[model samples]
Target: MSSPTPSTLRVGRRYRAKRLNGPYDAIVIGSGIGGLTAAACLSKMGKKVVVFEQHYTAGGFTHSYDRNGYEWDVGVHYIGDMGADHTMAKRLFDHVTDGELKWAPMDANYDRLFIGDRQIDLMAGPKAFVDSLKNDFPDEHQAIDSYMGYLNQVAKALPGVTLAKVLPNLLAGPFRRLANRKAPAFLNRPTQEVLEGLTGNQELIAALTGQWGDNGLVPTESSFIIHSLIARHYLYGGYYPVGGASEMAKTIIPVIQQSGGEVFTYADVKEILVEKGRAVGVLMADGETVRAPAVISNAGVYNTFGPLLADNAPHKAFYQMKLGNVQRSMASVCLYIGIQDTAENLQLPKTNFWIYPGTDHANQVDNFLKAPDEHDIPLTYISFPSAKDPSFAARYPGRATVEIVAPGPFEWYADWADKPWGKRGDDYEAKKEAYSQRLLEKLYEKMPQLRGKVDYYELSTPLSTDYFCRYSTGEIYGLDHNPERFEQDWLKPKTRIPGLYLTGQDVMTCGVVGAMVGGLLTTVAISGLKGLPLAKKMFVG
Candidate 1:
C-alpha cells in the first residue's frame, strides 16, 4: 500500500483535484445497501459523510441495470416483510425517508416449489402457509403441527440470537451481559439437526426446508437461526419495488445529499489508510486520497480485511486464518431474456419458482455444487420483473422480461478471474452460450410459449460476479450460511482496526432484507443510541 499518486479524484464530498480539504465526519467505502443505509442514518443525524463505490452504481448486489431496454435486478429476487408494519425492512426504509419509496407486493403465494413432480405453493401469512402444507401431508398433520411449533420457537428466537452475534465487543459493557447472550445455545446445531429433531417424515422436512437454496445451504449445513429468520420473514409477506431494484439506491441518495453527504459510483477504494491503528481514510483507484474521522465499509468481510486493508494494521495472521475458514455463498448463472408477449398469455406467475431434483435437501446442495443440470437444476429462482413492476413493461413496450437463476459452480470459470469482464475469450463465450441455451431449454420446459419469444438472452457466471463485485471467486452473497460460518465470531461488522467497519451481507445474514438490516445495525453502532432516531421512534411508535 502506497500513498495515492494523484490522478484519481472522484468524490461525494467536496474535494480539489488530488486533495481532500480535511476530514469528514465519516467516509464509507462501497455504496452497498448496508453502507448506504448507515450513511443515510448518520446523515439524518446531521453528519457530514461521503460514500465511495467502485462500481458504476450503488446498491451492491441489489443494484440493477438497463440491458436492451429491460431493467433487471442483479441479486434481488424477492424481499420479505415490506407490506406489513413492525418489520425492520418497513421501518428502516419508511423512517429513513419517511415513506417515499413505493413497494410492489409479490403474489400471495410467495414461492412455488416444484419438488419431484408436485407444485407446492408456500402461501403468505403464518396460518395460511401452515394450512397449505398440511394439505400436502394429511397423514403427518400432527407431526407437521409439531414442526411448525419448532419453527415458531426458532423464528421468535432469532433476534435473541443477535445478542450472541454482537456481544463479543460488549465484553467491557457489563458482566451481567453474559445473561443477554442467547444465540450460542442454537449455534452449535445445524438446520437438519434441529428439523430432524422435530419430525421423522422426510417429505415434510423437505417441504419445510425447501427454500434452503435461498440461503445457499443444505438443511444439514445451514444454521437453525438462518432458517428461522428467513422462514419467519416470508411467512408474513414478500415484495419487490415498483420501479425496479435501482429505485432503492436512487430514492436514498437524496437523504444522503440533503445532510451534506453523497454516494458516488466509479469511486474505487484501493486501500484503507490507517493512522496509529485506526482507519482514517482510503486511497482510491484513480490515485486520490481522502481522509475522514471514521470509516465504514460495505465490502464483504474477506475483501475488506484480506485484500483492501491487508497492510493497514496488525492481526495479519488472524485475518488470514478467519479467511480460510469462511466460505462464500453460491454464485448464480442467471438467464435473463426479453420476451415479446404478456405473461398472462404465457401463464407466468409472479411467484418465484423453486425447482428441486428430489425431496432430499442434501442432494440439492450436492447438485448445486456441480453446476446447472437438466434434472436437478436444484433451484430455479425465476422472476417476472415486468409483471411485478409495470414500469418495466412500459420501458420495453409489448415485451416482458424473464430472469431465470440457478447455481453456477466456481470452478466453471477459474481461468478468467484476472481477465476483463465479458471478454473471456472465444472458448469461454462459447461455453457460456451453450450453458445459456441449456438453461433456456429447461426454461422452455416450464414455459413452452417462451420458446421463440426471446429477443435477448444472456447468462452470468460466478466469474462475472467476481469481476464486478471484486470478491476473490465471485461468491455472490458473501459467505455461505453454513452453521460454522454463522458462529465464527470473527466475521462481525466491527474490525480489530479501531476506526474501520464492515457491512453488506457478510455483516449480518444473507438476503436483501438481511443486508439492509445489517446496515441498520452498523449505523446503530456508529451513531450509538443517542443518535438513532428510528430506533427510539420504532420502539416508542
Candidate 2:
C-alpha cells in the first residue's frame, strides 16, 4: 500500500494573532455545525462574528479527510429531510449556506438491517417504511402503524420542546406545561419500553429500533424522543451533501466571511474569560485574549463547563453538579477502506448497512462490553461514501471508499490515552489492527467481492477521536441520549452567566440536524426579540 499524503481538504483560515479582526459582535468557540450555524445566522443579522476551531480543519465532525488516495467523512453519513424545501432542517441549512450547499438522495431503500439471519430494508417514505416491515412480519401490521403514528406525534411536539429552549424560563414554563399535557405519555420514556407497549414481537421491535446505533444507545436506554426524532428525520430517505460532508463548513464559512467574520482553524481556546459575572471573551492557548460582547460555546457541555471555564468562574460549581446528571455517549472505532476501483465498477450500494448479532440489542451491547473479544460484535454500521456522493468519482477518479463503525468503549484504549496520536506504541497498533481485521471480516461477509479488492485501510479508535476532536472520552455524540438526558431543562442555549451560551448536540439531541437546531436556538436566545423574525422563518416556515 502507498503512504498517505497531506490532505488538501483543509477548510477555514489558520489561526494567528495578527489575523484577529477584533471588537467582534460575538465569538464562537468551536466550528461544529452548531457554532457555524449560530455564527452564520448572527452574520445574517448583521452581527460580525468570529469562530475558533482547535482542529487542523473546521466543521467538527462534518469535516472529511483524505489519505493515500481516498476520502471519508468523520461524522456525517446520511441526512434526511433534505429532499424537500419545506422541512425546517432544509430551510435552516439553506439559510446558513445561502443555498450553496446541495444534496443528493440515496437509494429508496436507504438503510438495510441484518439482524441475525433476517434481512430487513427500511424503504423511504412513510408508506414504504411501514409496508417494508409489514411485509417481513405479516402479523405485526397494527404495531408498525402505531409506531409510525408515534413518530408523527413526536414531530408535532418537537416545536414546543424547541420553543422551551429559546424562551425565557418564566415564559417557557407555560409552554412546557402545555406540551407535557398534549404530548403522548411515551414521548420521553425509554425507547424499548414505548415499543414494547405497542407490540410484543421481539423481531418486529428489533426491526423498529434497528437504527439505534444512530443515537449511540440501545432501545432500552435511549429516550423515545431521540428514537422518534431520528426515525422521523429519515422517514422520507437519506441524502448526502452534493460534494461531501466538508461542504457544510465550506459553504457556511463564505457566509460568515461575507459579513466580515472569519472561522479560524488551529484556534485553541484555553479558557472562557469571565468578568463581573459575565462572559467577556476567550483566552487563547497562545495567551492572547479576544473579546466579544457574547461568547457561544459549540464545544460539548463537559468541555465547556470543565476545562473551558475557570474553576472560580461564576456558576461553574452549579454546572459541575448538573453535569453529573448526564452520561457521555458511546465511542466507536471506524475502519476507512480504500479500493482501487470506481464505485460503479465495484457495485457499491448507496444504502447504509446495520449488522447486529441478534434481536436483543440491549443484551448484545451489554454482553459485548463485558467481553469484547468473546462476544459477538453488537453492531456494525457500514456506509458507502464514494457510492453516495456523486462528485466522489470526479474528485478522486477510479477510487471508492467504505467506512465501517462499531461500538468501542473508551476503556478498551484508556492505557494509550496519554500517548501521542501517531506514536501510541506497537501495542496500540496491534490492538487497532486486530479490531480492523475483525471489522473487515464483517464487511467481507456482506460483500465478499471486495475482500482482496481493498487497496488500503486504517482503523481509528476512541483515542483518535480524542486527539482530533478533543472529546476526552472519545464519544461521538456529545452526551448520551438517555431518558434522563431529555428531562434536563438546563441543557438549553442560555446559561446563568450573562454573556455565555451553549450550542451543539449537548444543547438538544445528537445528529447534524439536532445540533443545528441547538445553534438556531442559541441565536434566538442571544438576539432576543430581534431574532423573532429569523426563528419564525426557520421554525414556522
Which 10-residue window in model 1 sums to the lowest lDDT? 1-10
Candidate 1, position 259, lDDT: 74
After superposition, the stretches of candidate 2 with alpha carbons farther than 4 Å from their true spots are 1-7
Q: Give the lDDT of residue 137 in candidate 1.
A: 78
Per-prediction CA RMSD (Å): 5.3, 1.3
Write model 1 residue lDDT over 38-115, tens digit each, in one string. Answer: 888878878877888777667777787666655567877778878876766788877555478788887899788878
Best by TM-score: 2
lDDT per prediction?
A: 0.73, 0.94
Which candidate number has the best lDDT? 2
Q: What is the Cα-based lDDT of residue 162 in candidate 1?
A: 48
In order of listing, the candidates' clash counts read 1, 0
| Local distance difference test, candidate 1 | 0.73
